[model samples]
Target: MPVRSPLYLLERFDPGVVQLDRELRVIAMNSLARRLLPVEDKQPFEKMVLSFHPERSVAKVKFLLDQAECPVSNPPPMTMIINIPERVLLIKVSKLSDLRGDTTGYTLIFYDITELVSGELPVQPMTPESLSIEKPAPAKRQLHKIPTVSQNRIVLVDVETVTYIRSEGHYTWVSTAQGSSFCNLNISDLAERLDGASFLRIHRSYLANLDFAEQILRDEGRVSLKLRGETTPLPVARTSVSRLLEQLGIGEVDAQRT
Candidate 1:
């Protein structure tokens, strides 16, 4: 059999096909794709797709976007299976580049996997209830203050004063320039409950405030970060290094990477 035209495949292909612009704005979607996904041209893909699922999916797409290469000659595409309410979609995103190997936009192709494997997967709509197994959380929750039980009393602390959070086994300690406070919540609990952009999970056991971050120091096969007005350094993971360095200033440097 002869190979089909790219134009023909795009128009007549069975799988849901979509073309996204550089800004992740939906430019076009084929008939099958439109029927599967509730999307329209010029609509923001992140905002639209995020509506179906946000909490867990945002980080996934972000990783894909970050791993996305510049040109056709670049690295492999980022692909993942996203389970949304009612359907499971295999989303594959890659760089759409010009002839000169310059990235112009992105092409996202989605395949509905639900039909392939019936009742085994959760087909229920990814509702706020279903999404929040721990607690009934919406797709997005705006957080202004952290509520914690202290001295047998509920204490509401402003979000800005928080410098970092340290988890000691079951308990999570929220630190500030003023001092540290004990919260019944765990570090992972705080990671999900609070504003994610404001707090960076520098390591498994620690979350650092971007506002309070002063510098990242690497020494003797170990990596640590410093916050404003703080003496001791916090642990930094290898995977978290690039993002931290890209965002915050680098202070002291030693020999090796952790």
Candidate 2:
């Protein structure tokens, strides 16, 4: 929710990159995106969709393309699975903001989750007792949880695979290595549902999984935490930096939030 550095964000979305105008014309594309383009239709993105499995998905794809032309009413990150020639790509669509902080277009970051679908890497379920945080004495009221991420459907998610939970206006987005989904609960409500040892709230808008905490980055006076499966760094609060580092088993060396 703070001013995020665009430079790092660009780095986060490495490999798959495609820039489009409001009308959905391909303005610029990286080498990876270029490679995926069909030989005959190198002109514009809207006219040329590479390949799709179910025919109905084509219409859904177009709706998302149109959603990116301007600022989105609810930006919780939309994800769709599309099949291209020989590969299955997981496209994560995020809103791209302009100088005035208005939504300009959308950015599509592609990830190949074919192997995962093929049963190579499986989604592990996380239990509250399996985490490694200090336990407080049992409370009078029993705290029950499903440890599941739900949008339209519900799937039990392991705490280890959870990357982060972010607040987007009234909704909280829960993202795992498997995928991301919108939760009906607010950030505070979602945080209480997660295991304390593994999940920590770094910012008022961000709760992170320590298991995925890869590195802590301090760039241009802003401190952020880089998770394993994500390209973007989740912003950390200046006041909670020390405590977060301790929870993640990271040493201190001038970590501050912008």
Candidate 3:
């Protein structure tokens, strides 16, 4: 079978494309990619692909590229959704090969979906009936499984398995005994969707599951929490300490006289 050209596949969608050599250096990119990526001022064509992305995102991009390589012909493209500043991008990576079926390079294509996922689209205004004080507020539904991404696929993590969630800009890192995976939803959104009784906001950046609470470490007025399986302690805000203790059914033991 003949090798399929990256340009041939790129013709189907109006997406940003960045072509890379086997060494992972940028070989070429479409005009759309140059405009969307943060490489306008620098000579980025010959630089490594990882250099163009944020430090936090380098691992994810590397994972995407690694997953794209396959010995089989016409392998499925690896896909991932990532957030950057005000924009969200849906990225896909496919490996390029030579006529002898040897790996030659890679092609990364991305489409912007910020408006679709970030609530930037216009919404309908509430009517008087919808805002009536007579009506009680609807109960927030608890999330059973958090939507997370691993490799090139989306994984649904059971709520009970989650130990904590850390906010990263508009996205989050969902951590469990298995490991941490990227979540597209922000911490605030997860807080609203999770069971209020089980999940507690310990700090601006951390939401911890009370079920996994092992110890509360206090040092010099600063408070942090240790989970059953996790080694590192999660920082607890000064304001949230009292509420955290109360939620754990300990009830401000520090305030009690010895």
Candidate 4:
């Protein structure tokens, strides 16, 4: 009987080993790999990897591996995410080669990263606008110098004087310390005009001035804001809570409350 090579033994021992050909097709997969992927006994491997959404980390790995000066002999491991219906995988890719100074392919090892992606881990808060998932509110005029309003003439008001702004149909109503004014603008448009640090979108219909905000209150995923000069409290959505807390420099407060 012939003795097995150490490399072959190592491949068999690995819990998450996936072998791919030069064409990025899956040539072989280990037991763990089979469990991780949704593959049938007769299905092609390359098709499985390509079915995944183009991920940034994976693209970077491909780029590095394709480089002419790639140090495949001692290729550094790479981390990436692979999205599957049930969960997202956090994968590490390592290069594998033959003994005769010839490149073979890659070995992929990965596990679930659903918790990390879901903000279960400590992560920086990001606005919906930043994600490009939702349109931001329209910008209200800044309140630097008070605007001169005539009895019949319309005037633009400073956004800083406003305690909060609400969306109503085709126009947004800006509420200030003095009074409220109606303007023909959408919330998304308004959000772009105001400074991100000064204004915060708490709810789909509301944007509050953080400088004028007194404090934030949370109850079972619900958030409410207390403005410095306003008697009424503002409601915040659960999705906006983290961003609001981070904007107010009160992330610690939210963490403690949670």
Top-scoring candidate (lDDT): 3
Candidate 1, residues 46-159, lDDT tens digits: the string is 444334334545655655565676333665666655444444455667788778777777777766533232322222222334333365433423335554445433354667
| Of 1 and 3, the candidate ranking higher by lDDT | 3
lDDT score, candidate 1, position 93? 75
TM-score of each: 0.43, 0.41, 0.53, 0.41
Summed backbone clashes in each candidate are 1, 3, 0, 19
Candidate number that wins on lDDT, 2 or 3: 3
Q: Is candidate 1 or candidate 3 better by TM-score?
A: 3
Preferred candidate (TM-score higher): 3 or 4: 3
Candidate 2 lDDT score at position 19? 68
- Which candidate number has the best TM-score? 3
lDDT of 3 at 85: 42
Off by over 4 Å in 2: 1-151, 254-258
Deviation in angstroms for 177 in model 3? 18
Cα shift from native, residue 85, model 2 (Å) = 50
Q: Candidate 3 — worst ten consecutive residues by lDDT sum? A: 117-126
Better of 2 and 4 by TM-score: 2
Across 1-258, the per-residue lDDT of candidate 3 in tens digits comes to 564432333344467889999989998998778666667556678888988886656777887788788757899898876545434466889998889888889999887543333323332223345434457864544567676777656566788999999999767999999999998667876787778899999999999999999888877778899999999999999899889988887767553421
